[model samples]
Target: MNEREILTNYVYKMVASLMQNGVEDVVISPGSRSTPLAYAFASTKNISIYRQVDERSAAYFALGIAKAKAKPVVLLCTSGTAAANYYPAIVEAKYARVPLIVITADRPHELREVGAPQAINQISLYGERVKWSAEFPIPDDAPMTLPYVERHIARGVSIATTAPFGPVHFNVPFREPLLIDFQEELPKQTFRNSLVGQIAPSQQAKELLTAVINETQRGFIIVGELALGTDLQQMWAFIRKLKWPVLVESLSNLRTNVPEDCGQYIVSTYDALLKSSIFKQQVAADTVIRFGAQPVSKFLTNFLTETLPTNYIVIDEDPMFRDSAAVSTHFIHTAIGEWISELSIENTVFSEEYLLKWRTSEELAAKHIQSYQEIEQDEGAVVRFLIENLPDNSDLFVSSSMPIRDIDTFLLPTKKDIQVFANRGANGIDGVMSTAIGFSEARKEREMYLLIGDLAFLHDVNALIATRYQPCKLNIIVFNNDGGGIFSYLAQSTVKEYYEDLFGTPTALSFADVAQMYEMEYMGIEDFKEVNKIMEPQKNPLRLIEIFTDRQQNVASHRKLWQRIQQELEQ
Candidate 1:
């Protein structure tokens, strides 16, 4: 066979292997060196292709798809700085445990280190951020090339989907003929059959569970962001039977869709009540069973440390040290679902009086937050309003920094089927808009809403192009505080000299102009009266509603809201 034929076979095998292993979606950023693979993927049957112009936005878009589908999404980009642009999403996938198959094209070995254009050391490029990384040999007529490509692709997919799933990288270098110009007919695709298995929890897991139930009277379950495919129903069942108060984080997607039966044990407003020293002292636990990643609430983590629960245990499938507060007494390395399921069979319930204390505090704090909404028109009120009014079966993707922090602080628990998502792995504000748009595209049938700050929205303004290409209905609510409003609550707000220039970083541009540029419908919200009309179902596919606020008032309102909750808890 000629070199072109051999290379075609290698590329075909790699794509075929990914299909066999169940990868269905590919996000491609156009580039020259990746022509062969790009055309191959585009023409392939059964795989969906999503094209994004910006490489950085494309990577995060892939991350959102992976997050929503709970499966691996492949990302294709050209060589050089194009591949480098994928670093932010790579770090997020690693920490967030989202499965991503990142493929980048490169020049042949001879082109390396000779001042070659668009050539950089592609070997081990995304070091430590990816679960595995390997460079595929330039396709040739070598006997082992076909089989090696087949096996390597299968292994890469396996690692990405296995326990502690994460991003994996494969750099494919192509020689001169980056296209199969003359194909007699496409080679019949071949597949590699690999059986993946899981290790069940041993009897020791059960024994440890018995000890936890027998020794501890006041038990608490802190549910942070769960891994993909984590059944909230099953978790709720366990928590209901265990009769323990569960502090569910916003990203856990647990604060909503709460069953009426389990509502009493679910403490959704802990961030409000936990601010008061009296409330924290009143509701301390003897044993804490934490699950998923760290909780978003700094107040909850500090409460965990101050209480110093006797048996503070954390169960995670990944080996990553999630206990940043340094309060875990035991680390159980196992699947959270499996462990919780086994523990449920014991049918042990903790103190109802302890649960009642949490219930009372949750009730009081929620009422205070609701009342604050009636009288106030601040960022906190906006968080509550958006969450409380989200369309049924829709998803809410909140930006990091002030947006997510506000959701954690004031958004009350509900029985609605609204799913909440955020990029909390690295927790940067760079790709919030793109991530939400990608998520909406992935779940095309559902309406999606993005609650983002001005800076985050401006950071990814280019992502608005995705709405035109993918055509998903996204209700973008921009809290245009004119600057980094979260900084107002930070220490830098007191730094009179450099606070406005450095930390606040105010950008006075009108989002209405931005909306017009994208041809998206724009509405400027001047007061609470306008929010109701904006919340009505939008006619256009992409709608931007800008809610303007004062940075100083935002900080003061949050402080007053916390103080109000404290007084209510005391009452």
Candidate 2:
């Protein structure tokens, strides 16, 4: 076989191994150097190929797919900045523990330091952000070429899906004549199944945990932002057995997915209640056990930090310390599922009065929120309405800044079995639209809803073009507050001299024209009543719902709500 034929065979086997090991979706940004991979994935019947033009958007698009599917999705791009565009998504995947396979096609070794076109130092480009990195050798006619590439593919997938799952970098260097239109049959070879490592606490550790549980009278469990579809059912059942009050973060999905009876134990409105000194004092926990990543609500974090519980234990699978408070008495590094399954609920029960305090506080806060909703239709109200009205088994993608904070503060506990997603790892406003679209495409069965800020929508506006081809049940509700509404509440807002230009950075662009250009169903909603029509289930695959509000008033409304909560809780 010629060198090109050898390369083609190696590529086919690598692609086949990826498919064999749970990589179903591949996102390709068209380029010459990556032609072999593009064509190989396209021809593979089991792999679904998505073509994206912008490399940056494509990377986040793949991140969304991986997040929704809870598996590794592949991304391929040409050399130079095309691979660089994958950096942001790689950082997100690393912190969020989402599995992604990033393949960057590079120039041959001889081209190094030669100032070749579309060529830069691609080795270790992603640095420590990736779980593993390797330079896949150029394809050769040697006998070992096929086995090497095949084994590399299998190992990369295994590393990505393992606990502490994240993106893996495979910088593939290809020699000239890379665009050859060669097709070859994949050899039938036995493949090893990916191995996952699991650890449970030692007998000594379990005994310590049992002692801690038995001694605590007033304790709480905080479920923070979790990996997509990380099964919390067993953990929830364990919490139920312990009968402790639970605080479910908005992105945790537990707040939305728990059964109605579970509501009596869930403190979904603690974000609002914690702002009240009276309520915070009344419901303080002696012990606090946390799972998953840090909670998104600043109030909850501050409350835990100030309370300084006697026993603060964190259960995390990753090695990184998620606690910013530095108040943790113990950090248990073990798989959450196994830890919860093995936790022995001895003859110990939490105080009913302690649990009742949290339930009453949540109920009181809910009443205040409901009253505010009846009177106003601001951004917070819009957030509440979206959460309350989301269809069962839906996917809700919230953008960072104000949108995610609003959902965390205002979203009430419900029995809805919806999956909530957000890119809170890096917490940047970039790539909101593309990420949501990719998520929608991955979950075709569920209706997808996106709550995004206008700036976030405009930052990744080009992603809208994708809907024209990969349309799904996507309803984008853009809060067009004219500027960075979150800035209005920040300390910088007090410095009015430079706030408008530097912090606010308002963009007066209208999405109506863009909507028309994209042939999307657009609705300009001024009255709160009109949102009902936009949110209702529609056969149309893509729709944009724009709601305009004043940034100044948004901040004022938020402050007023907090003040109201404080007053009600004090009463």
Candidate 3:
């Protein structure tokens, strides 16, 4: 076959491999260098291709799709700076553990690094942000280059989808014959599934668990974010059979069907307990069972570190503990769900005193949430409204800064099955809006909601541009408090001039203008009562609802809410 024929065949095979490997979404940014790959991807009827002219937005849109789908999503961009624009989303994916497959068309090896136009060090451009990176060389004299490229593409997709999944980069170096007709009979490419790695619980893990099973009179299991969707029912059954206390984080979907009022189960993240000295005295665990990824709160991290349990077993699919403070006394590499299913523990009665104490704590937390003020124009009220009126079965995606922290502290989802996702890995607010948009796209059937601040929304406004996939029914509730409200609430705000200019640079851009620009439906509500009225029925595709508030008042409201909680605890 001629060079053009071989290249065309290779493109066709790669697209076919991606489709076969369950890649249903593709985002393409217009550029010259990537025409062949773009054309090939567009031709695949089974795969959905979204067209985005802005490379930065396109990359984030793809990131959103992957995050929502919990599957690999492909991003195609031309060589040069177009490829470089994907860095933010790549970093987000790396930290968030979202699977994004980035395919960039590039100039050949000969044209690189010599001040060549549109040629930079494309290899490893993402640094440690990507899981794997490879540059595919154009074959000049190979008799059977089509099959080789096809095989590599299949492997690359597999590697990208494997556990501890993140972004993957493939730089295709194409020469002058980039523009080719699509009339060749493409060769078939075989898809191979990569094997996932597994590690058995260490000897220390076995010994630790055995000791806990023997001596510990009271046991508690605390499940954090990224730790749900496992067979939590079995874990629930196992713990309940032992009459052990189980504290489920809002993000940990394990609390499904387990009533918050259940004596042995407490729902909130021990937020109320953190306020009182009685918390330290009453809530002491002989053994603490921790499963899943790290929790989202600094307070929780501090509590876990300071009140170290006699025995702590960290059960995680990923062996690495992201938490520096709470290094696991025993690390279990197996899935929490799998371990719960395998363990055959008899119905052992726990001391009623431990369960009674936890139930009292639960009552205290419930009272705190009930007494939380309902006044509008404050952060506490905003959160209270969200927790009360969040649509049933709605997937909630929160921004990194204050929004998530407030949600963690104040808003506890009444519906236990609601799926909550946040980009806490790196915890940067750069791609939050785009990531939420991507998440909505992946979950098209369900209602997806994003509670973001103005700064985070402004950071990725380009993401609102046209998307190719079926746009998700997204209800974006933006807390337009002008600037970085979180920073003002922190100690850094005490610095007068520096805090005003450097930290709180409130841009006066109107959300109405942005909504008009994107042609999305917009609603600006100043009254808190109107929030539920507007958010009642969500529209398909996209809708932006801006909730206006004063930054100073929001911060004060948060403080007052905490003070109220402390008062209730003391009483």
Candidate 4:
């Protein structure tokens, strides 16, 4: 066979293997080197090709798609800096456990170390940033070459979508005259992946957890950032079976669509409640059961650290050493729902008073929040209005930094079933817009919203390019505080000398111009009541609703709100 057949055979098998392993979407970064791979992906059946010029945005877009669908999304980029640009998103995908198969086309082996242009040692390019990385050889005279390529594709997808799933890298070096022969239908090749069953908790582990659960009346089940497609019903059922208070993070997506009685145990206002010294002192947790990643609240983190619990247990399916407080008595790595199911104990009387205490605390803080909402038009009200106005069965992607905290604080538990997402893995502000763009692509029918700060919005503003081609109904609510508003709430704010120039890092960008440049409809508003205009999508699908806010005023308002909550809780 000629180079055409060899390349065609190899690339076709790779694409088929990806599809066989349930890869529905492929994000393509257009370049000369990746032509063959791009053409093959486009030619395939039941596959989507989202062309993105920026590799960073493309990688994050793939992350968003994989995250939303709970499936592996493939990213194709040419070698050199195009692949390097994926580093940030790769890091995010690894920590976030979002499955992404990053494929980079590289120069052939003969061109290595000879000062070849567009070639810079592509072997294991992503290093430890990816779960698995290897150099995929060009299709040649090797025996079983087609099968080998197909098998490796299967393996990579498996590794990516397994327990503690993450991004996997594949660097394929191609010679000149890269094959783009998709005119004639190539012979179909497919590989079946071995079933990856859920790893249940060991009997001994179950017995111990059950024993702890039996005695745990004053326990708290803390749910952090859960994996994508996590069943809220199962989480709620587990909470019900244990009858323990569960402090839920917004990203867990377990806080909403809860039953009416869920408010009794579901602790959404723990961020606010833990701020009160009196409430924190009164709320005692002996056996602390934890799941997912760390909580969003710094105050809650402090509470956990200060009050050392006897049985501090953490059950994570995506096993990682996330114990920041260094107080985990037993770290059981298994599926949380499975662990809860296997527990021998039913609901027993631990401390009804403890749950009552939490419920009352949440109510008090919520009351203050409500009263504050009625009086002020701060970020909390901004977030509150956004959450309250969301259509049923929608997706909300809140950016990191202030937006994440704002959503967590204001997103009350409701029956609306709003799915929330955030890049809390690395928790960086970069790629916020791109990730949301990709998320909207994956969930095409759902009403999508993005709550981002100005810096984050500008970081990946080029992501709006994807919307120009792949249009989706995305309501981007960019809270333009003119700069890093979150810094004002941190210790760096005390150093006023270098704060504004360094930490403040204000980018007084006019997002209206950005909207016009990107050809997206723009709306600017100040009054929180104007949020009522946020309604069903009409003529324009891609629109930016920019709300200008003051950084200093935001800090003052947040501290004042926290003080009021603490004062009321102390009463």
Off by over 4 Å in 1: 181-191, 344-349
Compared with the true structure, model 1 gives a TM-score of 0.96
Write candidate 4's Cα lDDT for 1-571 as tens digits: 7889778878877887888888899999889888888889888877898988888988899998998899999999988899999999999998888999999999888998899888788788888989998778777868877777888888888889888889999999888797657844545664556567775788888888888888776889899988666766678778776777889999888778888766678889899888777787788688998888998889888998899888999888755757887888998878656457446776476888888898888888878776776767777777877787788989999999999998888877788969899888899999988999899988888888899999988899888777766756788988888899898888998987988899888866768988888777889887777866666464588888898888888888888888888888787
Question: Which of the predicted structures, 1 or 3, would earn the higher TM-score when compared with the native?
Answer: 1
Q: Lowest-lDDT window of 10 residues in candidate 1?
A: 181-190
Q: Compared to the true structure, candidate 3 yields what TM-score? A: 0.91
Better of 2 and 3 by lDDT: 2
Report, for every candidate in turn, its global Cα lDDT versus the true structure.
0.84, 0.83, 0.72, 0.84
List the RMSD of every prediction in angstroms: 1.8, 1.7, 2.8, 1.6
Model 4 deviation from the true structure expressed as Cα RMSD, one decimal place: 1.6
Global lDDT of model 4: 0.84
Which pairs clash inside model 4? 217-350
TM-score for each prediction?
Answer: 0.96, 0.96, 0.91, 0.97
lDDT of 3 by residue, 147-243 (tens): 5666666677777766566889988888877765574344455545545454456556666565576577776777776532355566666565555
RMSD of 2: 1.7
Clashes of 3: 2
